[model samples]
Target: MLEVYIDGATLGENGKSAASFVAKNKQVCLEGYTFIGEKTNHEAEFHALYFALVTLKHDYSDEILSIRSDSKIVVDTIEKAYTKNPAFLSYYNKIAELITHFPHVFIKWISDKDNKRADTLARTGLQTESTVIQSCS
Candidate 1:
């Protein structure tokens, strides 16, 4: 099984929003974060989930995957199979599409204390000097 942790953060303004993910297995660990122009904290959280799904889908297509996030909206929206907010519909749809490509995917809600690594990476992503998005894994 492959395990992934994701989180997002916003600094002061629209430009500071960022998303991050850490994916790991017994053999290797891959983690990264990227600046996401202007977006709300919820949108940034979705972006983090999106990045992790996209990054792992190709390589773990046939494996069971588990993803953890500190955002309740992101986790509950997926786990409950509904979203009342129109602003989140697009992200919900994209996540649904991505899940189809994998054999199995689980989205779980986790405490902030348990998600420190992704949170730190997301904050670090905001400190980048470049306006252009940057990512490292």
Candidate 2:
């Protein structure tokens, strides 16, 4: 089974956000982070989940997935497998599609304190974006 940790963060007045995910097994660890331009905290969280699943799909599709997130909104909605909000539903739909690739998937909500690595990666992404923007000015 692969354990995945995902997190998202937003920075600046424009809400430039970033998504980060880490997938690791006993012998390997992979990390991914991307600045996803402007987005709400919720949107960024979904994007993090998306990227995490995509990462696992590429190399661990057949393995059991133990996904973890600090966002209650993301974890709860995914557990229910439904959402009424249009924006959230959009992500939910995409996530539903992604789940088809994994034979076994389990998601659990965790505290922010427990998800430090992913959280830091997400903030790093935002900081990197800010650096680029600042350098351009």
TM for every model, in the order presented, reads 0.89, 0.90
Indicate the worst ten consecutive residues by lDDT in candidate 2: 128-137
lDDT of each: 0.83, 0.85
Clashing pairs in 1: none
Q: Summarize candidate 2's per-residue lDDT along 33-62 as a digit string, tens digits.
A: 888999999999999999788767877788
Please count the clashing residue pairs in each candidate, in the order shown: 0, 0
Candidate number of the best TM-score: 2
Flag regions of model 2 displaced more than 4 Å. Answer: 12-14, 130-137
How high a TM-score does candidate 1 get?
Answer: 0.89
Q: Report the error of model 1 at residue 52, Å.
A: 0.6
